[model samples]
Target: MKRIFEELAFVNVFAPQSVEKTTDKTTAFVDTSGAGEVAFLVSTAALGAGKKVTVTVMGSDQSTGASAKAIGDAVEFSDSVGTDPQTIVVSYQVDPANPRYIGLKFQHDGDAAVLCGVAVAGRSLYLPAANGWTVAK
Candidate 1:
């Protein structure tokens, strides 16, 4: 029998925290070697008054991020930003082909301070979905 937990894995891309205006925040590269389809969740707390969160994806061959490079275009969940007034959870899907490691680089620009976080959940195609789990049948 296939278990749901056995087919999915989650990683903290960026923990929830208050981001300062015009400051660039970056996350360490995460290994996605065996993942097939991955979803990145960007959560925010009350982004208002033209406050914006811009996120860009970077791909690397190593987790150290020394070989990091832009994988694709930047994706913003709700950057029109004043449009949303409450905590929102936005998600994006990615299928990395060449790189084994991926990281996020984002910036928040606005007049108000906002709490934002990011995470990734992925399904593996070349290896076990979960990092480490023991289940008996």
Candidate 2:
């Protein structure tokens, strides 16, 4: 078995006043042109009262266009009033031919913005005939 690691796509902290009130903050696009499996690592500094966060994988056939579609259901992590810091990690598999571009979406909901950090990575194994592997450089 071959193993590969992707580069860190994004690393930043998001706060209520910094981000949009009702919108999704997507990370830098990753070229998963030949990747068979992708993974996302999401972490948060701290969560305020009535705050929640959801992470999902988004894909597209074209680098930049309207053909992009969400890969699957979002993985949600919520915090109640006066909760501690939280973190979530998830992975997803994709159709190598369909999802050429891969990215992560960070969705936040609450009266106050909760500081959060998100990063994405991907890996792929060589096909039987190709005998080669690719990863984020």
Candidate 3:
């Protein structure tokens, strides 16, 4: 029998780009301060849509709470799982200015965290940064 392994998924948000002063070619990570969405690349072999993904965000400040609106605006893959040859990506509206730590929890079926993944605190989301908040996932 083949052993199944837990995986670390990479989550990123593609901030909009601007027209270069010298060139017209577009770019990635340009002007990240503007409005955008938080996105993640998931492994279909591991998870799928409507799979009850729990996203958690944390930061360094006590006054700041995870942006619920941001997570709510996320868009899920339609036919991504087991279909798209490329990595599955999901997007959620979020504020770039805020320090953010995001975690996405999917149904693990029966995979034990000790065996395949690291254990995450249920509510210990925020962390201390220089002086700001960030995604804790």
Candidate 4:
């Protein structure tokens, strides 16, 4: 038998730094074909006073993001307190019926360009899993 380790099946990195404050970024589509769960992480430098940024997780059927669309409403993060730097993450459970590719989009509304990193991680479902689970002595 093998330890499942909740294997990290795949990862995609975007905009390690140098995110333009006025431009929007749509990341390259990442294949999520076999992952059972996916996590999206966005780490950003100080967001500048009164500035705002929006993070969106989207899905597409094509690697070029030809059919891209947000999975849900874009989430907004603001530096209401001024110069707030933070890391935010969103997780999604893979649905076999949905498109097999996903990506991230960042929209910045501020005057200062911030250093940011976006990472998408795909994790496999636990091995030896069945339709139901049970505990034994």
lDDT of each: 0.70, 0.62, 0.30, 0.75
Better of 2 and 4 by lDDT: 4
Report the Cα lDDT for candidate 2.
0.62
lDDT of 1 by residue, 9-60 (tens): 9888788899886677777677876666666667766666556677777888
Top TM-score: which candidate number? Answer: 4
Misplaced by over 4 Å in model 3 are 1-35, 46-87, 96-99, 108-137
Summarize candidate 2's per-residue lDDT along 79-111 as a digit string, tens digits: 775467667776767675457777777777755
Report residue 19 deviation for candidate 3 (angstroms): 42
The better-scoring model by lDDT among 2 and 3 is 2
- Model 2: runs farther than 4 Å from truth? 1-17, 65-67, 80-82, 129-137
Per-model TM-score versus the true fold: 0.71, 0.65, 0.27, 0.75
lDDT of 4 by residue, 1-137 (tens): 54444446545567577787768888777877666888887888877777887888788998888878888788887777665676778777777676778888887776767787887777655556463567755
Model 4 stretches with alpha carbons more than 4 Å out:
1-6, 127-137
Per-residue error at 93 for model 4, in Å?
2.2
The true-versus-predicted C-alpha distance at residue 127 of model 3, in Å, is: 26
Clashing pairs in 1: none
RMSD of 4: 4.7
Q: Write the per-residue lDDT of candidate 3 for residues 11-122, one digit (tens) a residue.
A: 2332222212122111112121222444444432333332322323332222223332223333333333522222444443445554444444322221212111212211
Pitting candidate 3 against candidate 4, the one with the higher TM-score is 4
Identify the superior model by TM-score, candidate 2 or candidate 4. Answer: 4
Q: Of 1 and 2, which scores higher on TM-score?
A: 1
